[model samples]
Target: MKERNHTTLTEFILLGFGSGLGLKEGPFVVFLVIYMTTTLGNTTMVFLISANSPLHISMYFFLMNLSFLDLCYSSTIAPKAMMSFLAGSKSISFHGCATQLFFFGLFASTEAFILAAMAYDRYTAICNPLLYPITMSKQVCIQLLVGSYVCGGVNSMVQTVFTFTLCFCGSNEIDHFFCDIPPLLSLSCTNTDINVLVLFTLSSLIIVSTSMVILVSYACIISAILRIRSAEGRHRAFSTCTSHMMSVILFYGTLTFIYAQPSSLSAPAQSKMVSVFYTLVIPMLNPLIYSLRNKDVREALGRTISSVFLK
Candidate 1:
């Protein structure tokens, strides 16, 4: 067995999507458009939730957090990716990559917790309507929001520390777009068994536990809805959950596929596309999905537009 040198690598070249794809300026333009749209959509959602009195509730509170998370999450990766596409420079400094990984992990883990909190909120609202206000009080909501961030921060810290500690002796070209765990692990010259174990354990705990919360909440919500004697009541109750459910499915489905498997088994191309969908596309879709499907949001937007025009 040969001993590996622990040479300090200062920077890494992110071979984003690779030149072999033959994507010219068109993809850059498209990504720019998506980034702008994602920013606008999420910003609008946050603004609407904040400004509208009708939306000053627990559900919307959680929603506003989600919008903010999406905005930050997309920003962490999109701008850098777009710049690489335009400038044909794929290099990212060691610290720059670490920062990206930290924030990306932070927002991503926080969003998962927020979704679970939202599911619990829905559960309370529908299943225990009489106690909903007390169950999801202002203090409780604040606690939930704070807890989500704290959990995310802790998770991000652990993963970032574990990842960057590894020795990259020779190759510094990252196969994917951003600074992610799997690709980084693939590049490490030293043994990564412990890192892989920690990655799998932490990621699985976050995803599976939060997913279970959502599943149980929805199960209870459904049971309560089914007991509603009025068809209109049942429909209305179910309608409130549809948007969150869809977002959850889209997010968790992609994330589980990408992160749950060992890095050695992941196909770089397929993983990149999946990453694009959840990281970029999902953020843009979230606001649209919620606003377009909910009449209240549409009315609120209309009111906002009319107020500005009338002024």
Candidate 2:
């Protein structure tokens, strides 16, 4: 293996699902619809949450932040991807690729932290009901959101800086749709041992730590729910958590599969497909999951719609 110097590569060619069996206008159009729905769905959720619902409670507050993160994460990749598909130019300038990586990392990490905070919120509400209001006060929720963003921003900076530090003076073809660390590292002619190590360390920190926190919180929640004598009470309590659990499973499962494995086994096409789940499909589903099941959100949406139409 050769060591890579600090030389610069001007542009990167994205080998997006290249020559796959069923990739063409039909699939591209389908992706366009998914991208559009993701944007609109998340945007609608954010707007609805902000207005009409006085539930300035911690759960909805964190949800709003999650919606914002989803919108951002989707935007960071999907539009450029659509362009690549339509224009037959899957080329991204090096700086543009770095920019995508930065925002993608930032929003993704933020969402993970926010989800963990939400699990903790659920635990507080279920296990320590009396102290829920005090524990998840407005100030504390705001602090959590701020801290989430701060952590994400710092991590993004570190990852992006290190990722771009090595030279890509030879191959510029990235095998995935978006600029992800795994595929980007593959294109580098450098010995990316340090970069790979940093990526793995960061992945472990973000995924493992957050996941443990969420799991512990949920464990407490499940324990508290099981203590409820009535079957209906238990059912209702479990229902409230179902959406969050599903979202966590999908996001983390794909993330761990793509990142935790040896790069030798990484499949660019498969990674892109799964990336669509977390980045595009999840955003659309999250708003629906939170809003469709909750009466408060439904009322809020109704109020918002009425306010808009009547005015």
lDDT of 2 by residue, 1-311 (tens): 34545354578887676743233575578778987887887888788777754867788888888888988998898888777776656788988999999999999989989999999999998888899999999899989899989998988898899888877767788877789888888767767888888888887789899999999999999988989999999998888788789878977887787765557236667778887787788887888788888777888888888888999
Instruction: Report the error of model 1 at residue 265, Å.
Output: 4.7
Stretches off by above 4 angstroms in model 2 are 1-7, 19-24, 309-311
User: Each candidate's lDDT (Cα)?
Assistant: 0.90, 0.82
Each prediction's number of clashing residue pairs = 0, 0
Off-target runs (Cα >4 Å) in candidate 1 are: 1-7, 19-24, 263-265
TM-score of 1: 0.96
TM-score of each: 0.96, 0.92
Window of ten residues with lowest summed lDDT in model 2: 19-28
Q: Give the Å shift of residue 151 in candidate 2.
A: 1.6
